[model samples]
Target: MARQDTIDVRELSVHYHGHLALKNINFSVDKGQLIGVIGPNGAGKSTLIKAILGLERSKGEVSLFGSSVKAFRKQISYVPQRNMIDWDFPVRVKDAVLMGRYAHIPWYRLRSSKKDRRKAEEALDKVGMIEFADRQIGELSGGQQQRVFIARALAQDADVFFLDEPFVGIDIKSEEIIVRLLHQLRDSGKTIFVVHHDLSKVEKYFDHLILLNQELIGAGAVKEIYTPEFLKKAYQGSAAVLDDKDGMVVVSQ
Candidate 1:
């Protein structure tokens, strides 16, 4: 039997003012795959994600789990880049996470139910942040904050996860922990898409890749799409692909 597609994008395009950011992009991700979306700055990697999520004005057909994006919006979880969040928001860690449950609650309901709180606690425990649930989000370190956001997504219990630059500025320990958790999610049959910048860890971190440079360069398994030629094309011949002792490729631009 064939695997079911978790995300499908066809003829996706985005425009910022009069400038075209992404043009005619298309890709599909199957269930249980960890997908990396890589490109240089201004390559529209983030734009593509926003377009798929219907967070930006775009022309395309984006479907999640065989349904339209609007129809299944609550089933998807998105973790934006850290810079996009205001650290001084003055919200508690647990409260920040419980925000994920708002979609499940009716608008007439003014508070989260006990079941929602239980789910939030479980998510916090999974990220090892349960002890700090009462602390202010602004008081945590960068890595801890990122983990809290991850827990927020976890609380949503989403089938598809989209994270933008998740590892950027975090410590090695936190990065490792996040990667491990992501793998666990994939193993549990969730589809994960990350906007990643580091190419050195591509082979080790992701099973599939979407190489983008305002257009689709390549999209497939790491062994097939992560070639030196594709890297050069995606980075406009500025990327240096080096082979490590372990036979994995390390890319520098």
Candidate 2:
């Protein structure tokens, strides 16, 4: 297969208070591809994203768009887990979405032009939350709030989007809507990497998979890498697979 180079992380490692989270992780994502990072709890999935964003204390090199992460920050956008934010904060939906444009705005004198407002509104409409444009963020449901954050990321107009646990508390309908929106974004030649929860849907939803367990386990096309054997190894470190004359069988961890 031809190598598709987009975001390259070479020998990357992350540490927090002397505890190693990610170890010698390396992978390259292709442009316009939807990649899903899967792992059991505490397996360093979120830490990997943080390291790439230059937010975590880390080692080794992380290059985005063939340049240093800091230099390429403007081209990337992130949607953090909802629990990471203070939900009670006083901010309207539109204003929250507008925050994504701050990086592109002129410094010192803070102001939003008509173009900014239009873009924010359009993003909200794209996520089916236009009617809730002026609603206070705390007034929305968990799924609606997630969509608002997605709208904000959309407003960024960044080439690469990183979303963390976007499906945790969302309903099936909301999940489908978000997935469709992500596909639309990917079709427009953008890279979207999401930290997903549903294990069964990985093959159906993502083009690439980044399986983690404090270290890289597998990373490739879902159909090729998301096999039952891989899942067994991921969930049960030393577990054995069973087969019989009755037919091939998989033993649970």
Candidate 3:
């Protein structure tokens, strides 16, 4: 079977309070690939995702599953940046994960169905957080909190996943687990876009790269877009020097 493009963006642009954030961006993403949304800070990495997901007001054409994004809401799952989450909210770990299933419920139903509950439980177990399900969300470590949210996405069985900075504020152990889970999702033919920092891990983690800085810098395989020239363009003001022997990006202000 021919592979399908899960996401298609054309002439995409985003502005915040009259400030241009992304300008006339364009790209296509295929399913089953781990694509990194890479750029310097405030580079519209998150905005690009929001624009495509229809979470932000923008001018552009974005299609999911070869159709309007609005038609496929149930198949999409988003794990926003940590700062966006209300950790202070008194929600239990399991309950938080169950929230992802809300979209699947019909408008008439007031509660999740039995199957929804079962899937949520399975997702928690998959992330190794089933035992902690009874605990409060705020009490868990950064990594644990991340895992719980991932479990939320998993329960949804979403086809397209958007994760914003999944690795930030987490210990090494959690990072490793998240990386493995992402790869597993890719292998299972799920498309994922991760807004990532730490250019050092770009080569190791992502199958494809979307290098962005207000506009599209490059979008393709990591080897095609991870060049010094591309990195320099994306990190223009900063000094991004690439070592000749090994592919490591050294960035300094």
Candidate with best TM-score: 3
Mark the regions of model 3 whose C-alpha exceeds 4 Å error after superposition: 1-4
User: Residue 39 deviation, candidate 2, in Å?
Assistant: 0.7
Clashes of each: 0, 0, 0
lDDT of each: 0.89, 0.85, 0.90
Better of 2 and 3 by TM-score: 3
**What is the per-residue lDDT of model 3 for residues 179-221, given as tens digits with 9 covering 90 to 100?**
9999999999999999997887888899999999899999999
Pairs with steric clashes in candidate 1: none
lDDT of 1 by residue, 222-249 (tens): 8998887788888876667665676645
Q: Per-residue alpha-carbon lDDT of model 2 for 43-159, expressed as tens digits? A: 899999999899998998887767887887888999999999888889999999999888788887568988888999999999999999889999999899999999999998899
- Which stretches of candidate 2 lie above 4 Å from their native place? 1-5, 237-253
TM-score-superior candidate, 1 or 2: 1
Task: Estimate the lDDT of model 2.
Answer: 0.85
lDDT of 3 at 43: 87
lDDT of 3 at 21: 98
Error of 2 at 246 (Å): 15
Residue 241, candidate 1: C-alpha displacement in angstroms: 1.6
Ranking by lDDT: 3, 1, 2
Winner of 1 and 3 under TM-score: 3
